[model samples]
Target: MIRTFAFDVGETLVRDDRYWASWADWLHVPRHTVSALVGAVVARGQDNAEALRLIQPGIDPSAAYQAREEAGRGEHLDETDVYEDVRPALSALREAGARVIIAGNQTVKAGALLRALDLPADLIATSGEWGVAKPSPAFFERLVAQADVPADEILYVGDHPQNDILPAQAAGLRTAHVRRGPWGCLWADDPTVIEAADHRIDSLTDLIPLAGQ
Candidate 1:
């Protein structure tokens, strides 16, 4: 029985394609170019913080990212959604007796996505707050401690194999590969990236059954 669940926000819980497209439009750059910049940096697989900085210089990408999130709370939220099914999915998980929590490896505005979603996150594990990024196992450690759950009883669902999946698996937590098609899985399947998950869900609503502890 899974006692708790930690969800990743960007690609996992919230789907905001237009926001980036808007940026691409604003920057007069191809969306694929932006995607390639991120992909190239991620291919290097450096520390999470370093990776965010490598792709975006000058501004602390993490902090700048969060600022955008904060701004979204007031406006720009229409560009995204927390996934209409999220509430029912989380409610179903709770009905099955699982505590739902939110965690992310955002540079700065990691918390903003959760806040915008207005989900009742029992705990939030953010990379910006910890100053370390994912796949390090540190961010998961913080969230697990904050949620006060035994590692084995907690399940983490995410789109990023390195940032969310592997680290959670290493922390002794069960992992559910939330394969969201485009965002992160464009290269290959989630297993290709993490290769350690115990389960797979193509959508957020699929977690209904495992919410039971």
Candidate 2:
């Protein structure tokens, strides 16, 4: 039985529209342009940050992120930024005596923002706080340690196939591929994703039944 449900932040629990919009504004580029670039890079199986680099060659995303904060325009998250199904599904799972955790490859600031929303999760963690990012075995190692349970009993859910499904599966955890974000939608039916994911879900609510409550 799945005792713990750990989720990816971007496009899994939270929509990334605001994030991309902030970047577009920071770089003074059209919002659609940045969005398009992100899709383009993801389609090519490249890092999404490649879109930013494509917009402004040689740009340092971290440095640019700090500059955006200094200028009072940085990562922001609120109830509106969350997907409609997030609260209901997470809350339901928790109510059903399942542990719900939010862990993703987000920055420290984004982590803080996520906490401020007060979602019904037992824990909220970010890659920035952990000093490790996904697609790395070390990151999943941290997740397994934090979960404090047999890896097989934990379910790692995310919208990214490469970062979430494959790595988590390789780490011995059951994986759920959520088909919501660009990456999720585009690779939802890919053979690797289909093979790696133990479950394929259309929405967060789909996880409720899998929680075995």
Candidate 3:
């Protein structure tokens, strides 16, 4: 039985297309440019920070982030910003006696943002808080430690095959690939990648049955 469910944040629980569009606006560039840069980075299997650097070589990321945050103060995720299946799926899991958590690679301020939105989760942990990030054994170790459950009893659902699925599986957690985000869609048709995940889902609600209820 899967006693605990840990989900990746961006593109898993939240959609970030609008945020990137806003970044294009802030940078005074065409929205397509932002999209193209991000696509290029994803094609190369690079991380988000690297994408930002490649898009705007001399830009100051911290300042840009602060500006975005300041301009968007009081702006938090609305129901529409989340995937349609998140709430219902989480509710089903919680009702079924499963512990649900939001675990992802994000800034220190992300916990506050998630709390303000009142997401349905028992715990929320970020790389900033743990001082480690995904694809790293230490990060998954921290999650297992916090969950206080055997690795085999934890199920990690995420979009990234590399950072989320492979690492968690290597760490002994059951893995699920949710095919909605760039990473997920990119590797969706790859036999090796898809076959590695214990479950492949198009919607979060698919997790309900996998969690055994």
Clashes of each: 4, 0, 0
TM per model?
0.75, 0.97, 0.91
| lDDT at 120, model 1 | 56
lDDT (Cα) of model 1: 0.67
Please say which candidate is ahead in lDDT: 1 or 2: 2
Residue-level lDDT tens digits of model 3 in 1-213: 899999999899999777677777877889888888887887787765566787678778778888778887322456677888888999999988899989998877876777677778999989988899989999999999989999999999998888899999999999999898777798877786677799898999989877752
**Maximum-TM-score candidate:** 2
lDDT of 1 at 9: 73
Pick the lDDT winner.
2
Give the whole-model CA lDDT for all candidates, comma-separated. Answer: 0.67, 0.92, 0.85
- What candidate 2 gets wrong by more than 4 Å, as runs, is none
User: Residues 30-66, candidate 2, lDDT per residue (tens digit)?
Assistant: 9999999999998888999999999999999989989
The candidates, ranked best first by lDDT, are 2, 3, 1
Q: Which pairs clash inside model 3? A: none
Clashing pairs in 1: 62-107, 62-108, 66-109, 96-212
